[model samples]
Target: MNRPTSLVSALSLALASNAHAATAADAGAGIHELQRVQVTATRSERAIADVPNTVDVIERERMDELLVRDLKDLFRYEPGIAVGSSFGRFGLGDIRVRGLGGNRVRIQTDGIPVSDAFSIGSFSNANRNFVDLDTLKRVEVVRGATSSLYGSDALGGTVSFITKDPADYLQEGKDAYFGFKLGYEGSWDGLFGGATAAFGGERWSGLVAIGHRQGQEIENQGEVGGVGSARTKPNPQDRDGRSVLSKLVFAASESRRFRLTVEGNEDNADTDLLTSQGLQALTGAFNDSVVAEDRQTRARVAFTHEMDAVDAGFADSLDWQVYRQDSETTQYTREIRSGLAPPTLRDMREREFNFDQRMYGVQANFRKGFVTGGVQHELAYGLDLARTETRQKRDGLRTFLVTGVSTPVMLPDVFPVRDFPISETTTAALYVQDEMSFVDGKLRLVPAIRVDHYKLEPDVDNIFAEDNPGVAVSDISETSVSPKLGAVWHFADDWSLFGGYSRGFRSPPYSDVNIGFTNVQFGYTAIANPELEPETSDGLEAGLRFSGDAVYASVSAYYNRYEDFIESMRFIGFNDDGLMVYQSQNIAEAKIHGVELKAGVDLGALSEKWRGWSLRGAAAWSRGEGKGPEEVEVAPDVFEEQIVTRNLDSVDPLTATLGVVYQRDAWGAELAGRFVQRKDRVSDPSYYRQGGYGVLDLYAHWEFAPGARFNVGLFNLADRKYSEAGDVPVVGGASATLDRYTSPGRNLSASLSVNW
Candidate 1:
């Protein structure tokens, strides 16, 4: 059936279910996820409806019910969120909120920031998907600029992953618990399994969890297969991953608690680059065999202490944590080339890359509540300090198959080059926030401010200086201040209005400020730019929320203005040596505005005739534009620079999702459809454009026996062929093999779990 027909049929089924006659007592009340508690927005526990900022919380129950196995699956139904992917080997990159992506979004696991993404050429990519979903108990997502609370790298949003604790498993009479889960997904022929064990005493508790997964290349809606860039079939790939999480907790007194946590995860992939073959026939060189092995690993150890009864009168509670994290990515590629022409010689080329980061940090916060005159106030203050060392190296070698000879093949430069000098980045921040309540808690005000300082120190080594002779790497030190104001007014029963203004900023990265690359053969060179300014954003938002017995809904609108946007490796002009010079600069100003809506209706609560029926939906629409310096050619080989305003292609088009859910005693099912509008607004007219499309998904859950449960999901029920706009390059024009980017067609996923 077509997409529209499928959706109509699903809606018809829902309407029919709603018309059924039943008693009111037989109906069940479902939990509203939008009202859940979250901590990312203010660094303190607060319900989503009470906070002035936009926050979304996904609990473990939601993950299990939806059969979520990866980042893409986790956000399958979210309207304004997306996951980025390229080709078939790079897999999933960072998560995108609204329009901005990549390094603009901040991601953390248990308060430790994830590794940054860095890419050079087409062979090396280090993404930010280091956490395993199985080990997480909940995930909190905060939208819009939030630097006042998170310091830096929170320009677009923040995602925090909270892991499971031992107390979650121990029951009233049980001191130990064990659980197991197994799952399979058809999209990649993936198989995964996990186990959890926990034990607790009166004063101490411990928990350990482990998970493993193996999968093949992700499937797409393509048929053609062979070699070269024209091939529509995905490349052959094999991937394996494992994760381990352990925690130990101790309770010293009634108001004091301590926790020690250790977590690690690693993923490895081997891919055969079938799409890279038969591209180079001019130089009598053809890629006969190309293979790449990519590996990513992350590990962290942390200790935390919390005290509620502080002796100091200024503070009522105190929390502190110290941690050390290490993350690394390594990629190795080996290629063989053969010639059918004159020389009939063969050669082997190999490339190796290693990117590593080690971080040590300490964080502390205090909370106090007091009354000043006739006003009530709750104050929160915190300090953060961290030092990170980053290093990267790229090396390669070539060997002649005919003779016993080996040499490096990097033309116009030497092998074993360092893109940037080894550097230590130190960051320190202090922040304070106060929540004031007036008129018997009907009106609330929140004011917050933060001060941050960062310094980048380059430690040049012989390997870096030897590659780029006479190049001087400069150091950078900068400080920024961010402030925010928010208000919430409860005008009527079960209804409230909220608004906020926030500021955000990101310091220039060490690699971008001191990057070095010289390619004499290509008549181009990329140099460092220590004079670049930091990127900053100012955002204003307002929303209305309603919560009632039979219905709940929320509508929000936001506008964000950004300045001094950093553009990396931007081509300026020809230098004195007739080489095109590329440097990083602050070259753009942009504005993004959007509206979001979420609504749900419980038919069971309204009347007995519609028992066990519920309806839920969400929608998002956004538009963005950027003003940047563009070169206009007035004469042959001559050009003039002009400031131009154009639509930003990073912004996703309008999207809406609707679902019908039904619940009974021991079984339930849900049907959902996601509708996306066509994308046409772009800076370049020739950029690739996609038409509107809709996809239907179905999920069912069953608890047949005590401590045993099962879940099944059928996605893309209509077998629709579509692609996420973010996954496809916008400036590449039209591609002949557009089907290569299409999402999976008709897939199934199922999981089974047991506990005792």
Candidate 2:
């Protein structure tokens, strides 16, 4: 592929940076990974080696150097993490931490939680991919339950994105800064560009950043083409997105500051559903086809105040923020179905599905340092208050192509129906933690607790009433308390032992608690579950870490137990109306255990002859199972209850990543490999079983001038064809369809960035 003229011009103009020399020296792959500092673990700055938890921080430099284009690329080398997406319609969907994904993992930008991921039937899906990577300064990921500190939707882990600030670009004497980057990705056939500008005076500073991208469908390794289920190629698609981020800062004094931020982004995609052709056999229609267009938009405004070195009676430092975010997802789908037997091709149906949410929140936290007797203590406390309104609507029309007449009825479904009533959720929480050090600061013990209250109010409207009459929506109020204890001991020089115990919980979601729908033609009905209980988990983890000049390594193990797992839309036998009834229920108890290992060696530190060479690797393995009650029929019309235990299919098999890197004065390169074991353990044996595979990747960066640099990556260097277990859909007996989900083959990605 030829480079665009604009990209060529930008690259030529960017040829002036000597920054790569220092980047290679300061960002050594092995040393940097070992000594990284992060803020997500405890909402305070702490070195990863000192924090009593598993945390991974990806800096902007690393993101650029690796050519990370999406969440899948961001976590490609991280063990036990994966990104799942739709088959052909909605591109990226959600991030899976350990064995849990979707709402189980909490994601936030700055201090605000991201929008939720929701799915209904087969036509609509809304995900939580709202943040643009170009505007981010750093990303922090903490694995394991963090609800004691974060709140709901954190049973598995948490991911926090910190955006860039003016201070990051402006130097001590420089009052203005400007930079831009342009890039291309082959797998997606994408073109992207972004620019950042910052200007400031002694007391005030402002920054603005904008990014845009246009791309075609992501490529895959599938060989077959054409229409219907036999087509293994990706559907034809075109996608584009734009984002803007602006910030203003004011410094009242050296110890006090205020900041205002406004950010917004919009993404759109249109796909021709060749894969959906002839899939309407159940509807007695021949030669069926579908086309879909989707749009996602988010806007947020936030204000924050911070005071440091405030020797007040109540605290030493304080931070607070107030923000509002509005997000929406809209999908429009059109289907053309031919009449049975004669094949008239006259039936046309259109559907517009939407999910919208608005949130307002205030969060405040403070830190105080004090001494009691011989023990020095650092105390942290915070409070969170938020209210959100969520709504969903499904509207459609049916038309006769011959007469060009449209009708509102499309069989079992009517136009403009809500799966669940519009609902508002309000939440309030308070949390506090105290860090105490003993043995002359060699030992640390931290204890924390959080109290949270949540209320759900539903407003049933005419659309809901007309769609599902006689159904009553219920309100809910609930409270939960989560506690945690952690300890870190510096047992010996360059060695530490750390362990922690934490509790996590998630309140029942509005859609599950008050969901109501009926399919008269299919003889089925899904009702609400007003008595649903919250899901909770208790996790315990321990690890031993060694950090030295020549080598760094860590080995950790964890075990978690979960209760009241909600299973949505589960069949509960026939109702009095002789229709199959389904409802959400809390019916399972689960247990998961895992172990992780990470190690790196800096050869230069071992000997002078081995300078500029390093080796790093990480591996993870986990197993999970759930136990639930099942009804068995011993005689006619008589059923008895029995306990059944099944493996959790979501958990990926053992995986590992390894990298070898070498750095020179102005250039560096890394060769990496990712390996996964075969997935054989699953809850359903009929589900497709994927075999093990390994892939190799190469990445390099070079600085040709004082202010310009280029980074390139060759992924899947061997052109191997393999599918991640999480990306494979359940094809059941149809094994041929599995090819459609295979990952892309060899691809090239490169970017050129400049600074002034």
Candidate 3:
């Protein structure tokens, strides 16, 4: 188990650590005394100092005390982890650890898989996460694959959201409270509303909370055609948008609790990258619009019960979840792609799909006081089974008022601009895990295996249209098994070492193998290729952790061998026009390796002038390479030289964070600095490497009264000009419609919270 470091490493540390011990520890406690910290990523509530692996946690108070609004802000003190995409609004942030992102990483809410069977395709929206930030108590980020508590994507790593439970505010152990959030400024202008209430008696407890935010206009960093970077905003249409979220919970009995939640969010956004004639033309991300509207609704039921079972198990817990999403989208726009004809009105497309999923799991665990050859042994074993099914009511219509030289096709009901075929899919998996602790709980070993069976059935004739729209369809099925092994050794009371090896996979997308293009009247379509392989990876991870009340530090590194990657290629035919047709292909292998280190030391008071002073922070660096077609087609030619996620990400490979906060019983203020080098490295051949940048954020908080508090913060204080991620797309022909979505320039917001 990874535990916090002791007061000091050696006898010499006792004196050096004692100086700051009073500041890091509570005022009334011993210098090394530590507050209780509990973590549950292992499917059990245990001490953080006892878990031996690379992990990072951000509690609700810390995130709020710093006035943090974005997920990227947490990455400062954290290393080897990154949040993909900035638009989740707490409902959709993707995670990447050790440079393995997207489907490779698993996102969960209470141990349930977040993705569905249709989680595929470029720009695919996976994990319809409902755990909005307003309702979160904390998040546990397990780096690497030390423990596959869940299945599949866990091979890369696991990021799970643990919701806030009811808190007792009553002097008799019962409490109730409510609050609302509304904000307006240049950067993120929105109206947020929230309420929370909880009840706790000697033997019963309950909690409920809800939050929603509607926003408009995102801050601008720099516009391609703008005269200066000072005010880089686009036309009124570019920055207009809005979103919302809500949550609720109920509980009865000490070990049995249930939560019923009906929450959803909708966004009407401008696909601004599509341009008529602008600098974006140089990047090739055709600037064109057609507004996009996406919405999702989720209903979940979860119950946790602990029992001293007949099987001699000390504790057993069961969990079940039912998730649903009704997705509808429509696009309206016109574009003369070839410029050979008048701006012809693009075909109108619309898509609506319904997804309902259910997952039930039970774990029977035991921690018995047993003697193994005079040495104690504690073992936990459990079996897991989950099944998912999806049925959709789909309808799409696309017709050419007049066929142009080059015709463009879209997926079923693709909105006003394109049309595509519709299909249904179902998937299931089963798994088992065993963890044994011996030598008096000083050492632990866990082994897990999961088997999954996936199948997709689609009707070709109906999907392609009775008019013979050129589209191919097929039925397909596949199965796979993944194994994971891990061990943790508690070297001492305050230090531990751990390592693990695991395998994971990304099943081939049904659309790529089962769906094909159609020419309709042309009688030509890219034939469906049902023979496909899933993208897989085998990973190994190791790390050490040390903890104490005043000083806590950890370092971890991991390596992964990724094989059978799925990629799209130009294997299909091209029309007489310059346009080309592309099909999916199985591609080359890849590898990623990296090291991460983070430590915090409480810098105590230096003099009377520096009383109440404290300092803490961390730093990290990482890199990787592609070994297949990616290397040959992109990056440098050599396999070792090809930059992988370890390098191709938005920011630089080297990054770090530092912050200082001074707090008393009632007030606190802090200043934090972050540095992210520009990606001097690039996969594209066009632009020279980009320049790196650094930013400073400041936060302050004041207790207005016993139950009320006010917080104010300034972000991008230097008003730095930076891009969100690389605007350039590698691995293909150059095009001018590239997207240049940049970060906000400078903005300020004040949030006030009251607890009662």
lDDT tens digits, residue span 1-756, model 2: 111112111111110000111135533444645467888877777787778888788788878988877888778888877787667888887887777778888999997999998888788999999989888989888888888889988888998989999989888999998888999999999999999999989899999999999999999988888888688899999999999999999989888989999999999999999988875656667556799999999999999999998899889999999999999999999998876545443778899999999999999999998999999888999999999999999999988887788888976898889999999999999999888889887898989899999899999999998988887788989898989898889899899999899998989999888888887788988888878888899999999989887777888899988888777777788988898988878877778889988877778877778888877888889998777666556677776666667677677889888888788878888888889999887665766777899999999999888778999999999999999876875455348778889898999999999988
Residue 557, model 1: Cα distance from true site in angstroms: 0.5
Candidate 1, residue 4: Cα displacement in angstroms equals 38
Give the C-alpha miss distance for residue 395 in model 2, angstroms: 0.7
Candidate 3 lDDT by residue in tens digits, 560-664: 777766553324456554334556656545566766666555444334454555555555566654433322233344332232332333223666666666766
Query: Which one is best on lDDT?
Result: 2
Worst 10 residues of 1 by lDDT: 12-21
Residue pair clashes in candidate 1:
none
Report the CA-based lDDT of candidate 2 relative to the real structure: 0.84
Candidate 2: residue pairs that collide: 16-705, 16-706, 16-707, 17-705, 17-706, 17-707, 17-708, 18-706
**Model 2 stretches astray by more than 4 angstroms:** 1-23, 26-32, 341-345, 631-641
The total of clashing pairs for model 3 equals 47
